[model samples]
Target: MWDRLATDGLAILVIMCLIELIVPSRAKGPVMWGFNLVFSLMLFASTLYYAHFGSVPTYTALRELHQVPQIKGSVESLIEPEYFLFFIDLLVLAILWGVTLSKPKSMRLGRRPVWKIGVAAAGVVSLILSGWYIHNGGKIENEIVQAENLGFLDYQVAAVLKENRQNDEITDGNLGKTKSEVKKLQATFAYKDASSGKGNLQYFGAAKGKNLIIIQMEAFQNFPLHLSLNGQELTPVLNKLAAEGLYFPNFYQQIGQGNTSDAEFMSNTSIYPTGTIAMSTGYGDRELPSLPRLLEKYNYESSTFHVNDVSFWDRSKMYPALNFTHYYDKPSYTNDHFNAFGASDEELYRVGVEKLSELHKQNKPFYAQFVTASSHAPFNVPKDRQRITLPDSLQGTELGDYLTAINYTDYAIGTLVERLKQNGMWDDTALVAYGDHFGILPKLASEEFISSELGIKYNDQVSRYNIPLLIHIPGQSSGKVVERVGGQLDILPTVANIMGVSLAKEGFTAFGHDLLNVDHNIFGMRYYLPTGSFFNDDVLFVPGKGFDDGTAISLKTYEPVTDITKYRADYDYILKLMKLSDAYVKQLPKRGP
Candidate 1:
């Protein structure tokens, strides 16, 4: 309890000092008290955030406060009665101040600079202690563990320091050297058999000259594709698509602070998000090597469609950085009041299909991306939009709302397919659909609750991060379910292979491999999970202090695995790979202003 108080109270104390410095000496007492009360309330808010995200928010997360207004329903639902206790001191101080106001002016104590000196001194001491704690903590790999060791204030300080160090490392590094290191590391891994006479480039250029359409679904998970709720299919359209395409059941999300946008970055560039900040916000000025640039060589026009404002998550800079030829944002679609994003997935697809069809009519091959937002958080669907009926037990619950939203999203895809078919583009298009990240917050959606309700076992982190990846090639009618473990980082190479684009030949550096050809795969994730954590074919391993003290859980069984000795190679490999990815991305030339 004392540790909790010390760690949580630091923010409150810092706020108090700031108030002391700003307010008049005469009003310091009541003002400080009121400010401390507000700080306490913020602490409660942070706790709620931690409970939902399984990590503490740093200073960078504060930049997203402007987004709260858009997600007010979800934000409000996180508040609980216990958070009100933070206001108790404010209530007492208010009464005391009222009573003192009634007393004579002579009865009040005179202001002293000594009190200010003491507060300033305490603040300095707090800073010193925080720095000491962070220094002793060693590496800033796992943010949750770092925060636990150094407290929130110190963790924020450590984050800033670590980010600075990373920037310096990137600025000093050579891209050529990083690429060589990547090549050597990849060569060591036996991705394919050379001695057996099987070419490493199997299925390379399988569907050349095909128009590409990628749908990055928001907060969609793989579990819904195969699961039924109350005898009703949750994602019927996705299920049908899975039946007609290449389905990767073991695919995971590799997003960092950027979330959906990070997924976009990885899927396009196969590079790792720095994990300290949103990739879109941090590296959007870099001349990124991406699919759009690669496709442009083949005379393919690249465009992306999203219902949100182009500036959200700084995508305005990101799209240009990725070298997309065109983009359709909020102004391109009709307002359907679907959610905070304003337009429904159906409308987004309508605009996308029409635009792509126009490009096809001009005899131009296009690479079009559709970012779906109808199934975004709070999972609220308009009455007319909802296509699924929930059982009485889940009527107003988050689970029920999620299913309804997902069902509507699935229904919308059918409309997109119909439009594509009507435009005579269905037979020649190569379609890929995958989720940006996980949706369910573990605090509200417990493992037992999900297992019992959905009749399927769910591991908090493993299953939560697991998302669907379905790629439908033109002229293919039968589906293939590949059991290889993969992440968003693998999407580029995988799609490139099917589209007959050779990354190696183009001198493109990708941190991920082709999920279609690779027999075994491993990917690292550092956003919701710790930096050292990695998922292989067997288990998800998370480090404690270091790899020696780490823990592993079986992906298939969702149970704890005691012996993690076999996964040491994967841990080391993934760490090296992610470091190389960071270096490679940072070394890229900055885009012109």
Candidate 2:
């Protein structure tokens, strides 16, 4: 506490001292007070961001503040009464200022020569101290530790400095060279032999020449796929689909600050999100190589559907950048007031199928992307729209609210499936469904709370991030559960494999591999987890400072792994892969107007 206090106080003192030197004596107090008030709000925002995103937010996060009103339910739920303490000082200041206005008394701090000299000396010392803290903390690769060592305010400054230094180290050029380097890197790294039991070409061309419909579900996780609550099945529609489709139990989310949109970007592009900014806002100017773009060669028309405005998260810019033919958002759907995002998942799919039916009539093979919103955070499904009933014991609980919301979302999917089958499109469509990210927050549903309530073991890190990835190629009879560990980045490659699109022949560069074909897979995660964190087949590795100070947990057992010596190369390889992904995306050519 003292270290953080000293770090925060020193940065404020340096700024205040500088303001005093420039401003008139009478104005100094008021100016410094106003600046401090703004600074306090920044700290409060950072705290709240950490509470929501589980990461120390950078200045880039401020760009997304306009979205707070759209997600008001989730934002309001994040606020605790104690969070208002940040403004208590301002209230006291306001009261004192009102009393002073009656008396007309002035407060000055820079008039005296001695006071000015002391202030300058104090500023120099604070500047030196804060600089030392930033320099030390800035070198740490793990952002969580970096935020701890350097306080919130200084951490932002360090982030800027680090980014500038990195920017200076590289020069932008063709993505071809980067792709070549990526392929060479993958070739050198030792991948686990992936072809002992299954056929080397299993599932290839399984859904060839089929219409593609990818459903990105909101806040969906894997645990509920086959689970029950109070004698009620949580997700019957999804359970049925899982029993008949391809299920990936070891898949996880790889979203950045953009949350849902980031998942969409990574799944389509097979590229890592930089974890510093929303990919839609940051890289939407670039022409992204995506599943839509790949299928366009085969005369497929790609269209995306969401119930919100395209302006949210700048999807207006992203859809075009991804070479999508059409995007149906906001005005395209009927608002049933299902959640803060406006329409229910049922409405989203209903509009999706309606639009897709027109393409089917034209004999066009379409790629339809449906983004669901009914199960968004602060999961409050309207009582009337709810599909499942909760016993009195679980009524108002966070877990209970979540189950209700997802139950409604699942029931909505049954509508889409029936409508597709009615249109004679079910057998001709490649339906891929996956969660955008983790739903349950740690504060509301910790391991102990979940175990007591659900009578199941839950690892906050392992199980919390594990999301479901199911792919249904219409003609397949029985479901196959693939145990390969994968992230959102692998979605495009896996889908491409199923659809018989040869990425190699197309010269398409993908950072992720075919989950079905890869012998052993290891993928990195950041933003939520630290930079060095990764999940391979056996364990999830999270670094504190670096490799030596990191911890690993068994993905299968959810128990701590003591010795991490063998995992060092996987850590080093993921870092290199992500760095290449960052550089590759950064160098992508801007879309022409």
Candidate 3:
């Protein structure tokens, strides 16, 4: 409890000291007290945020404060009476300041170097102790545990130090060396061969001359694909598409701090997000090896469409780094006041089809990506757009709101498909659709609530991160449900294979494998889960200080496995793989401003 208190107070002290440095000598006492009050309130807000998200907020999280207007309702629900205790000191100080102001004379410590020195020494001692605490934590992969062990202020410092160390280690490294290492590591594992005893590269280039369209659905989960509520299908459009395409029900989301944008980065580049920062904000300056850069060689024009401003997550820089031929952002679409994004998914698709149709008229094959925003957070859908009616019990609940939004999003996709078909591009295009990340927060939508209402067993970690991945090949009449588990990292390799782009032949390095061909798969997740947590064929393994103390849950049963000894190899392999991914990304050439 004392450690926790110290951890919480550290931010207040730093803020107070910074305020003291700028204030005039005569006003230092009251001004310092006022700033302390303000800083305390910030601490209270952080506490509430932590309670809801189950993760400590870093300084970088402040960049997302502008998103509060869109999620105000959800944010309000997270606040509690206990969080206000952080402001108790502020309250006491405020009352004391009022009393002092009311008096004719004020108490003043005039030029007391001894007292100032003592305060400075105290701050120095606190810093030393915090550093010592972090050192004692001993390299835990779990961010939550690391924060708890080192406290919040120290955790931020440690995160920076760790990132710097990673950058240093890969400073002189080359992608060729990393590619060789990855090949050697993969050769150690026994992936399933094709039926002909040849490699599973048979499907490569099956759609070489086809146009490509990828839809990155917002906050959509796998459970809604065929599920019905009140005899009404939740996602009828996606259901039909899944029936006619290759659907991977076992696919999971692997986004980090950037969330949707990170999903975009992974799907396009096949590299892992560092989990310490938003990939778009941090590595957007790197000359990223992506689908756009590869397809450019085939005379294909690459473009991406989104309803939000390109500056929202720094996509302006990211697009150029990925070498996209063109992009359609907010100005390119009609604003329909769709949440904070300013335009509905329908408007986005309308604009997208118009632009792609122009390219099609010129007989140009193109790569077009649509980033949906209608089903974003706080999940409120306009009444006119609502397609599914909720049960009386869930009418005003978060789950109901989510379903309503998802249904609207699905309906909007139908419009895009219709446009494609009308333009005569459907038969010649290989369309891929996937969800960027999970929607419901575990605090609001508990396991019991989901199982009871949705009739689906929802494990917090495993099921919450599960998203749908569907790929529709032109003229393909039946769907195939691939059981292999995959993540956002696998999207690029899988799509490239379908497009007949050979990463190996082109000397491109991919941290992920082609999900359609790989018999066994393992993917790492670090944002919502711990850094070392990984999902394999049968289980989700989460590390606890180290492997021996770690835990495993059966993916099939969502129940804890008694013995996790057999999964040790997966833990080691994933840890090494993620480390290599981090190193490889750091070593990439940075694009100039």
TM-score of each: 0.91, 0.96, 0.92
* Model 1 spans with C-alpha error above 4 angstroms: 7-24, 30-38, 92-127, 138-140, 188-190, 193-200
Residue 385 deviation, candidate 2, in Å?
A: 1.9
lDDT of 1 by residue, 19-125 (tens): 76677767877676766676676678788777666667887877666656766777777777887786787778778878877878666543456766888887777
lDDT of model number 1: 0.84
Positional deviation of 4 in candidate 1, in angstroms?
5.2
**Number of clashing pairs per prediction, in order:** 1, 1, 1
lDDT of each: 0.84, 0.88, 0.84
Global fold similarity of model 3 (TM-score): 0.92
> Model 2: per-residue lDDT, tens digit, 1-593?
56577788888889888997778866865886788699779878877888988899988888888878888888778788898788888878778766655653334334567888998999999999999999888889999988888887798899999888766544644577888889999987656453465455678889989999999999998888888887789989888888998899999998999999999899889999999889999999999999999999999999999999999999988899898999999999889887778898888988889999999999999999999999998998998988788877678988889888888888998899999999999999989999999999988877788777887888899999999999988888899989899999899999999999989898999988888888788899997898989999899999988999999999999999999999999999999999888889888889888
lDDT of 3 by residue, 207-295 (tens): 88899999999998888889999899988998999898889999999888788899999999999998877888888999999999999
Show pairs that collide, candidate 1.
205-500
Q: What is the C-alpha local distance difference test score of candidate 2?
A: 0.88
Model 2 quality (TM-score): 0.96
RMSD of every prediction: 2.9, 2.2, 2.9
